[model samples]
Target: MAEISAVKEAWEIRQRFKPEIWFSAPGAKHYENRYYANHHHSFVNISVTGEACACRCDHCNGKLLQSMVGTPTPLEMRRVVDQLLDKDCRGILVSGGANSQGEVPLLAFMDSIAYASQKGLKVLVHSGIISRETALGLKAAGVDQVLLDVIGDQDTIHQVYHLNQRPEDYLRAMLFCREADLNIAPHVVIGLHYGQIRGEMKALEMIREAWPETIVLVILTPSCGTAMEGLQPPNLADVGEVIAKARLTNPNIPITLGCARPSGQYKRQVEILAVDCGVNGMAYPDEETVIYARSKGLQTMFTEECCSLIARNV
Candidate 1:
């Protein structure tokens, strides 16, 4: 099949770069005697708004928020973080649905984040289109890092996110993080244009220019009950091409495949190709990928935290 052939070709082309294997699921994943050593209760995600989002993009329709434990107020978030720390959680990802401006109103929760940090919890915030003032607040709060999605295509921003903002808005946000001297891991969602590859390379170029602490590459997963539900995933080879370009553009920066993508055979195939295409790490990779990496005589390791933390951990 063409898909199989494309994967093989990409694999052949990917041998030039050294590879690093990552196993970053909060829970342990075992394959035979080998296991990804994870702190099952070490890290967790919390949503500020339970099952609610103003953007409600075509691909998500607020479904992604359902998986995150929701806390609507600073007091609630503080209470939840205390409970999680009591249970031995190492870090927490503070996330929520964005408002109409594609911003997660995190200013209101800054005090809670600071409180968690003071109580010795590593804090990571998914800050969307933040202002310099807000970025400073997050920095003063002792937050570990921030995650911001960078979209290169203007049309994708409008059509998929239903936002009138331009790519410059994203670039400016990264600048805000930099001005605050905050650690940031900028994410670029591949194939966000209705399951078709678009602007990934441009986005990578922008990220490379920004010089982020780390870069996370994720693929768009069309969630159920959304307009993009029936759309097929982009070609694995095309995804590989984007990865290859990213490697070439930012050779020193750490790039990892984040824990968001299509599942089943498609996911397995993409993982194998991702290893070859020079991604430094992967979040929750398939067992066969571990075997393949070992067979290629590459050293591998695992972490219980999110792949975005590789920059800080590794």
Candidate 2:
């Protein structure tokens, strides 16, 4: 493992890390796909309104949002949840683009989720950036889990999100959720600085200030029609380094590799590194990582459900 002290070190690590990154390839497919089948799952989203996002960040510009069934209104969301239950869908993760204030209008869907909960549909939510009032409302709605991005640098905050708020605001939001007793999963994106682990470690340090049950680490992938198209992903070892750090820091809490991690060898590498670092579970993991975990004497499983399930086991 390297110190990850400079971009030069990251570049050097990237070239050397590729060979070792292949460790995740063993658990390639089918063997563990069922782990998420009957147990935990999430509906892929498409579209970018009501239940979709508007801000569409550079790494993902709402293209992923298109997979979710359209729910443009509260009642519409209720109908969709009903349909989901009829289809035997596990539950739903409600998210959308940010409003002008950089917050998702989650209050609109809270009551509707309460109704869905009655039908045995668990609800996990992604509130891009939030205020205290909304956090309280989500807790009152009986929401299952809440995920928020915790940023460390004000520069990445303003440049990437195009919103100006101190790191304290995000800290406040996470603390608020804890106060309301909401199951919180804070996210830290690696290589947000054009393919380097700049703000990620800082995010972990910041999260240590609060009480999120779990923290999901995902690497940024450059998407077309955006500012970061074609930029390489962060080194796999860098991803592992952070995961190992998070594991050592909170030994008891669950750390997950979220759905948006980089694709191809980088993706496989991430899965393998997760095992070495003692990751409890993974979301949509590449086949290789699963195989590697088994070889290393770890029990492997996959889930389409949100990473918060990791909290329950920990």
Task: Point to the candidate with the largest lDDT.
Answer: 1
Query: What lDDT tens digits, residue by residue, belong to model 2 across residues 1-314?
Result: 32434323332323322122211111112224433333222343311264355566666566555555567778888777777677676666777777655777877777887877677767777887787888888888888888898888777777777777767778888888888888889988887877777777778887888867887877787667677888888776676677777766655566677767777776776776665666666666656665676676555544445665566654
Q: What is the C-alpha lDDT of each candidate?
A: 0.81, 0.67
Q: Which structure among the candidates has the greatest TM-score?
A: 1
* Global lDDT of model 1: 0.81
- Estimated TM-score for each candidate: 0.91, 0.84
| lDDT (tens digit, per residue) of candidate 1 on 107-190 | 898889999999998788998788898899999999999999999999999999999898889988989899999999999998
Alpha carbon deviation, residue 165, candidate 1 (Å): 0.2
Cα RMSD (angstroms) for every candidate in the order listed: 3.1, 6.4
